[model samples]
Target: MKRWIILDRDGTIIKDKNYLHDPNGAELTEGAADGLRMLAGMGYSFVVLTNQSGIGRGYFTEDEMNAVHLRVDEMLACSGVRVSGWFHCPHRPDEGCSCRKPELGLVRRAQEELGFSDADVAFVMGDKKSDLEMAEALGAPSVLLMTGYGAEEYAKGARGTLNCGNLRDAAKAIAEFEDGAARASFSRDLREHAEVVSAMRSLEAQAGAAASVIISSLRGGGRLFVCGNGGSAADAQHIAAELSGRYLAEREPLDAAALSCNSSALTAIGNDYGFDKIFSRQLEAHGRAGDALLAISTSGNSANVLEAVRAAKKMGIRTIALTGGDGGALAREAGLCVCVPSSATPRIQEMHILFGHALCGIVEKTLCR
Candidate 1:
């Protein structure tokens, strides 16, 4: 999970020399090296995404531009900081190529080249409006340094971006923001998990009761049918796998199946009947008297899962619904409903898997004995 910062070259990293091809003219902006060193220490790699349109205008050759970059790299290397990638667009403003700033070409090219296509980029920092626009396009925050064209661009009104006096200030601001966000996120996660633990404690008796029913049904030669949609669907498959294979101890495989696992039956039923009938149709095929249907739905109102529960009831199969949000309509229909107290979908899903694992463990113990 590497994080990176996209930087503009001419004005942001060094003095904007304006088509000057002399490597001798390359001069680092005040505090540029120090800022870069700080960011590097914070686990951020750097990518110079610049618009070197002077090549398109025939002001300088690409070879001359490389010389300038080599000089810049040498200066940064003195400070123990390295640019992981350097991407420049050699198109004039009138060229209409996708690689220019405010377009995603250079950024996309750098991401692909550096193996960071799916990585988290902290922000884009530069001294021009085009840089901010590029950051916005990439769904990242922008830092506008009042170094080169930044003051003029700021006067022209580049709103909704962090405005700093220099690269050093920008780096400090970003570091502080990231640190605060990390701490706040940690605190929020801790609170949310604590809430989950409390909810689980309240639901312990109901969970135990559900495990008892599942154990009895399986011992009496009844199969378990599990079904849901989306993340809940994944949870359904996981729970079924735990039961039909083994939870903790190796024993005879239990008769269990996740209704969402069969892709052919799902697509055929969904295409012929509709999405709502996908689970119910599968339940009809596999469900029988004395069997149990473990229906998981975060919203408790997933049409397909609800339909499956109805079908299970009609076929004399016992229904245990793991749901959230006042249990929705599925709670009313199910014989036993374990509803996590929170309406938040993610929290509910976490509790559902915990409950599933606990139930599987209990069933494995009871049946093995």
Candidate 2:
């Protein structure tokens, strides 16, 4: 996947010249080209999201803007840097346009054109509150450069963004942070394995019971429906796949499906009945008495997952909760609760998959026999 940095143009990458329409007047800001080049070397691409109210105010034409952009491009080329996209909003503030700074239009357009979005970006970088606001909307981190209006904005208490002072410092800080994260995650995972082991050990009977519940349903030819949200959704799919497809040996395919796997049904249900009904609505359609649901949730508090559990109970379907931190309300609600005894999310997730494998193994061994 292409990692991106959604950047600002004027007052960020170039010296702010107060709506100059002349290409000859354009200048690269201090450390702008070099900083961009550093990030490019690290396999990062750039998208320029800017607000050019000058165009709407009739201070510059689109053709003139293009010429100035071309000039900026030449300067960037000197540093061996290239931007993947240039997205700007040409609307006055009073126009109430969606594409302006602090709005998401420019960033959204860039995401569409570039085939990447917030999930693929490292961070947004700019010298103003608008840039930070855009990053906030995308749910991505942002770099606040103390260039252009950055110092002024900072002085006025624009917080919650990484203030790296300037383009050069920002690049170095990002590089260091990335490097540190990469180095730490390896050791962190290893150290956290003890938590997983302890959690798993503490829940041996619960794990076996969760498996036996599914085995009984499978023996009775009942389908299994799994549901979760976000990362838990992925875990739900993984568990479903292992059962319905295969785990470690050749066997007859089991009946299973992830409620969140069908995008059409999920989206339509979510849109029509609200997000809380997304999973429960599907359960209503496909789940029958004696069928099983393996509801996965790290915190066991996902509204949709809980709703699904309630729906399953009303249908006389059995519910097994795979969750962490005392299993939230799901622990109390489910027929069986395999609570991974850790509050840390990652540790809980690790134990969840382990529990899923154990369940899959037990079911396959019992049924295939």
Candidate 3:
């Protein structure tokens, strides 16, 4: 759903001028255009409602007012801000017209045309008390800007969305309010993760099997090597750290290292044998019959990770894979593979860390004791 902003034109958007008529005189208030663009990016659309007494008072023609509005729109277009509706109450205050500020005529008319109701309005904003009054009529929130005649209203103790200094400040205030509202409620993101993990219960047997492979390799005085690419690469180093540092124990640190941790070797090998050989070349120099290599890839098909798995096997080193979905070629090639049920990369990565933690806990209990 599109969030809507009920806005006053002159003082709220452009510098308020006395009977603004000339298109050339239509200048945007400082930071107003940028703020509108920011709000627009956040899914807020605008409908400009203004009181133009200059037309009724014979100060400017209706055609002249439209020309000026067109000019303002041109300037706003440079910043990618498009006002959805343009409305003006061309009557003097003494005329007692229903379309003027503090009245609901124009706003109601906009609702009819724009397919929005008072409840759909996000906030009403202007540099005048009448603008806030418009919001009060709709029972919506309001923002009082410190531009144009707003200073006078502020001096008179008129409060809005906390007396914004500019449109930029007003936009920031609205965003902060939204963020606070979101934080106060339960997010759907945690629910998504819960669903992914709930589905992973079926992987229990596979995870236990993968953990057993690593434990047996370590128990025989064999080191564990881990490697991946991108986020998985970070996960590799993280898993290695848990094994090498201390996983809830005072025992000696396990012989575990992330092959990608050595930048010098990675770059030299990558430069010589190519990017595909970086992990495989590192495994060649370190792998033994008892050592185990943990290859992690969200897609289960990373070329470099596959190369590393193949090289570990050729050197008589045990291979274990952490992957997702159909488990790709790595699943079939590795000695053991724990595949996450989800096909989404983010969920797969999350499960990888969870499995990594489980492995750390399992091996620490057996090896440290």
How do the predictions measure up, each by TM-score?
A: 0.64, 0.58, 0.60
In terms of lDDT, model 2 sits at: 0.87
Q: Write the per-residue lDDT of candidate 2 for residues 1-369, one digit (tens) a residue.
A: 989998888888988889978999998888897788888988999889888899999999989998988899899998999988787889999999988989988877887887986799789999889899888988989998888898898899986457976777888888998998998998888888875786477777887788788888878979999999888898889989998899987899999889998899988998999999999999999888989999999998888999999999999999999999878999899888888878899888888788888888888888776
Off by over 4 Å in 1: 1-176
| Candidate numbers, best TM-score first, in rank order | 1, 3, 2
- Tens-digit lDDT track of model 3 for 231-311: 999999999999999878888899899988889998999899899999999888888888999999998899999999999
Rate residue 213 of model 2 by lDDT.
Answer: 81
Name the candidate that leads on TM-score: 1
Q: On TM-score, who's better, 1 or 3?
A: 1
Candidate 1, residues 1-369: lDDT per residue as tens digits?
A: 899888999778999988868899999998799999998998889999899889999999999999999999999999999998788899999989999998999988988888885348788999998999888887888999888898998999884368888888888988889889999998997799788878688888998889988887898999999998989889989999999888899899999899988889989999999999999998888778899999999988889999998998999999999998799989899999999998887788888898999999999998997
* Candidate 3 accuracy as lDDT: 0.90
Per-model lDDT: 0.89, 0.87, 0.90
Q: Count the backbone clashes (under 3 Å) in each candidate.
A: 0, 0, 0
Stronger candidate by lDDT (1 vs 3): 3
249 Cα displacement, candidate 3 (Å): 1.2
In model 3, what lDDT does residue 96 have? 96
A best-first ranking of the candidates according to their lDDT comes to 3, 1, 2
